[model samples]
Target: MDKAEILVIGSGPAGLKAALSAAEQGAEVTLVERDPFLGGQLVKQTHMFFGSKEQYAAERGFKIAEKLSREVEAHPGIRVLCDTTALGYYDDGVVSLEVKGRFATVKPQSLIMATGAQENTLMFPNCDLPGVYGAGAVQTLMNVHGIIPGKRVAMVGAGNIGVIVSYQLLQAGVEVPAIVEALPHIGAYHVHASKVRRMGVPIYTSHTVLSAHGKDSLEKITMVAIDQDRQPVAGTEQELDVDVLCIAVGLTPLTEILFQAGCKMVYIPELGGHVAMRSDTLETSVPNIFVCGDVGGIEEASAAMVEGSIAGLTAARNFGYGKDSYEDQLAAARRELDSLRSGPVGEKIRSGLKRLSSFGEVTQ
Candidate 1:
């Protein structure tokens, strides 16, 4: 058995910051990551981050991960775990996990769940073919593993992930024939769409995957245009001889653990499917189990890190680790998070969060 003053699940942008924040606040923090590597999606993000300097703005994702690694190493209060997965959670504050194939249990006084989100999936004939992959999986193969997902690709969904992955496909020498989106207008920021267009990849708005054809694996793809009602138009079918079909529809939070742990769950599309209800400090309905990052709502990595900081400080105060200035630290973290969510991209998040907020109703 192992123990810590605080336990942080999923070492992504949020978990990394949450563990570090609690450690800095004088708690013994245990940071666990399921992947063999740290940094989570940060490992695959090659693009530069945008925000204030305090949010590590202008730094590329991988560079920021390296910097976070160094910071985590410098702090003795944090214990790191890679290639570790939390297998189960119990009502007694016990989290069962397998660390490098070795089973262990951890009992933490406070728990911060930053388990992150899973890639959204799409369905069609041959959707389960070998050549069909998520944009994140393709990014990991190319950017993290230096292996191209395919020679030629048909991308589905023109959201930010789809757009960014399309650009990355170009960077990796893969051919993205086109990106198909169901919405009439591009679903991504203009800047990302512009980058892909500059590379000469066509953006097909009001389009969606019709089907994929292959014998053993993916051999070709078919797409069609849709009307304002999102129903397919009969005469707009288009086919491409592409071996790979990358799907970048969207992301959904990992909410199973929250349900099993007794946290209240609610569906909020604007917040990315179903999310665990949380207060301003990120605590869940279940005692001692706090949620941050995409698990609470599907926000950007910069925002996830700030949410982590708030949860960490909240956890610290709960265990009497940093009561003297918990309020001050928490206030500052909240302010930073609010600032990050003030832009147009954050409008949905603002409305979605209003559903679960009740921070002033109680204290830790």
Candidate 2:
């Protein structure tokens, strides 16, 4: 069995930051990523990030990935295992992993779960068609593999991912027919909406995709404006001639390992599905285990990095590293977390936290 002071799973913004932070704190850290590459979702994100400069905001995600990877590599104590997927976690901090075409075991004193999230799916008429694809999948094809998903695409859901992917498609010289939203208002940040709107992309609010049309590949889409209850309004049906249907509803946390490890979870939709509950120090119900980033909840990359740092620092302290000022460090992390959620878009997230923390009676 491989032994380390700290082990981080996943290679997304959270995992990389956690491993880097732990190593910087003088802990032997090992990062395991399921993908062959270092970056996870960030590598497929071609758009710039938001938030403060400290978090590398306004920079392309790929650039941030490159910078973070370099920093992680520079840490002699940090070992990153790419293409190593963690399958399960056993008692006594034993983790089962599929590494490089073989199985391996890692027994660490502390663990940070930063597995991130996966795309959510919606059921609609003819949704299983060949040309209907997840927004992230399309992004992976274009950004990572340098291949266009389709010539003309109709994007479903006006969330950040959808809006950003639509703009990316345009940047990739693909035609975005329209952005359809079931809600009465835009779902993404105004900045993202403005970027696409200026490009003459029509955003249809109060609209929903009813069905996709095609035999082998998508050729057209049927959309309709819906009432408050999501029922189609009379005479509001329309058909858009497109080649692809891209679904970008949202993402659900990748919590399979957490479930396998018997970590306590709460189903908070705002947090993006079943998430492991953590204390102020980001420690899960299991004393030696922790979770951060999208795996704990769906926030931006900036927030994930901070959360990952908190988890790493706490884990390091738990294993006798920087034990003197552990409480102070955790309190500082909590303050920074509060600051990250002190914005308009963060209101919902704040509410979710309130509920998750049970109105602060717990998790405080």
Clash totals for all models, in order? 0, 0
On residues 125-147, what C-alpha lDDT tens digit does candidate 2 reach at each position?
88898889999899899999999
lDDT of 1 by residue, 177-282 (tens): 9999888888787889999998899999999998999999999988999998888899899889998999998899987778888877778887898887766678
The regions of model 1 sitting more than 4 angstroms off are: 357-364
Model 1 quality (TM-score): 0.96
RMSD of 2: 1.8
- Strongest candidate by lDDT: 1
Clashing residue pairs found in predicted model 1 = none
Instruction: Give each model a TM-score.
Output: 0.96, 0.95
List the global CA lDDT of all models. 0.87, 0.87
Error of 2 at 332 (Å): 4.2
